[model samples]
Target: MIEKINLNNILFLDIETVPEEENFLSLDDDMKQLWEQKTQYQRCDEFTPEDFYDRAGIWAEFGKIVCISVGYFVNKGDIRNFRVTSFFGEEKKILKDFSNLLENHFNQAQHVLCGHNAKEFDIPFIARRMIINQIAIPNKLNLFGKKPWEIPHLDTLELWKFGDYKHFTSLKLLTKILGIPSPKGDIDGSQVAHVYYVEKDIDRIVIYCEKDVIAVAQIFLRLRREELLIEDEIIHV
Candidate 1:
């Protein structure tokens, strides 16, 4: 299905996010109440909202993006390289920069965005964060009334799903089953909030996020029945 899409025209991305506040107690009264309600069904009676706060990053309303790593394929004569770059810091700043990149460089009709589970997670998370930060949604991300086919987002997870919609697959599992090197050797998504909030290691998260981007690209190639990219071909920016 994706054989017709040019690899150079695709922008591969992944993001790392953390709770809006460093801790649950830092939330205002109303927000704290809201968070409790938000996680009610997911948390058991044994767990308090404060204990569950570590997972706040999963929800856009209670979380903020800390890093967004983007990678793209480039060619220079006989050389082919995959370059990855990250925009990170305060949530609003990263959102603004990412939105600008989308609006300026990747807004063309022929461009497609690919990431694992991006359609359900990353893409919408960025759009919602943009709105909350008062940043204008870029043309590519402004999905208000567009038809399903009009959306240019490509999700590796969805592509892997084929027609069955009841199951969920993690990127790590897919890589393992497909023989793609794991991107999450150091840490996984569940630890991101802790790493950012406790360790203050945004760089680590950025590296981890970039690894996911590379893995996503490899997964795409696997879908296309192409060979996987070798380690020497990746370039970080």
Candidate 2:
């Protein structure tokens, strides 16, 4: 079934996010209380809400997307190329630009969205943020009322699970085990918030995000028993 789907019809992507505010103290009194309540179970007397604030980016209500990087396949005859691009800047603009890309170019019923663990994280995060910013959700990301088989989304992490519901794998670990090149640089997801807030290095984050997109596409290729993408085949546009 995986080989039946045309690679060109899929848009592979990854996103980077950071907390809405730089620190706990920056939140208003009401939000502060809300944050505490939100994490009460997870914190469990081991750490205060402030200590757990760095992970706020994991939740749409308390964080904002900083970058969304996407890559799609372009196959012509014997040649195959993957074109990659990114949308970053103000959260609203990022969501708007990404939404437009989906609505305009990838709006076909056959078009699908692919990401690592995206079914649980990336897809919902984008939809939630778009709603918060009052942007209409793109057809590709809008899963409302769609039957399970009718949904046009694929998750590499879920694929790797292979019916093992308890199994979990990180992109980095999966890539290593599958022999795909590692995407990690000097920074990782844990450091993205600090890079965006303190170092003010969005460019670095964009590069990281793009790398993840490429890695995802490569992972799909591997899953289909195809060759991994050579560096020369990856184009950053």
Candidate 3:
């Protein structure tokens, strides 16, 4: 079934996120308490809420998307080019711009959004952030009342899982095992908050996010037993 879907119909993407504030103290008392409560089970006795604040980006309620990099395949004659672009800056602006892209260009019923673990993270995070920012959710990301097969979203992680719900594979690991180029550079997901808040290098984060998007597209191709994308085929727009 994966082979039946047209590569041109998919919008591949990845996002970089950071905590709403630079530090735990930056959050108001109410939010600080909420963060503590929310992470209690995961942090347990190993780390305080303040220490765990660095990972706040993993949750939409505690973090804001710093960048969303998207790519799509465009076939011009025999040449295949994957055009990549990003939306960064204010959280609201990022969400609004992405919403516009979805509503305007990729709004067709046959269009789908593809990412690594997108259904669990990228898709929902965007929806929640849009609601918080008071932007209307685009139909592509809006999952309300849609049957499982009717939703237009593809997840490389989910595809790799097959039927093992207990299994989890990181994109870096997946790429390595599948012979796709590693996406990691000077920073990784763990350091995104530091880069955004302390180093203030959004460009670096954008590059990292774009690499993941490319990797996701490559992974999907590999799963479908098709050729992987060459670096020369990637265009940063």
Scored by lDDT, the top model is: 2
Scored against the true structure, residue 169 in model 2 reaches a CA lDDT of: 99
**Regarding lDDT, does 1 or 3 come out ahead?**
3
Ranking by lDDT: 2, 3, 1
- Per-model TM-score, in order, reads 0.97, 0.99, 0.98
Instruction: Return the lDDT, model 1, position 123.
Output: 92
Give candidate 3's TM-score.
0.98
Please list the C-alpha lDDT of all candidates, in the order they appear. 0.91, 0.95, 0.93
Which whole-number lDDT from 0 to 100 does residue 236 have in model 3? 93
Q: Residue-wise lDDT of candidate 2 within 1-237, one digit each (tens)?
A: 889899999999999999999999999999999999999999999999999999999999999999999999999989999999999999999999999999999999999999999999999999999999999998888888999998899999999999898999999999999999999888999999999999999999999999999999989999999999998998889
The reply for model 3, stretches above 4 Å from the true place, is: none
Enumerate clash totals for all models, in the order shown.
0, 0, 0
Cα lDDT of model 1 by residue, 78-112, tens digit? 67799899999988899999988888889899988
lDDT of 3 by residue, 147-215 (tens): 999999999999999979899999999999999999888888999988888899889999999989989
lDDT of 3 at 62: 94
When 2 and 3 are scored with lDDT, the better candidate is 2
TM-score of candidate 1 to 2 decimals: 0.97
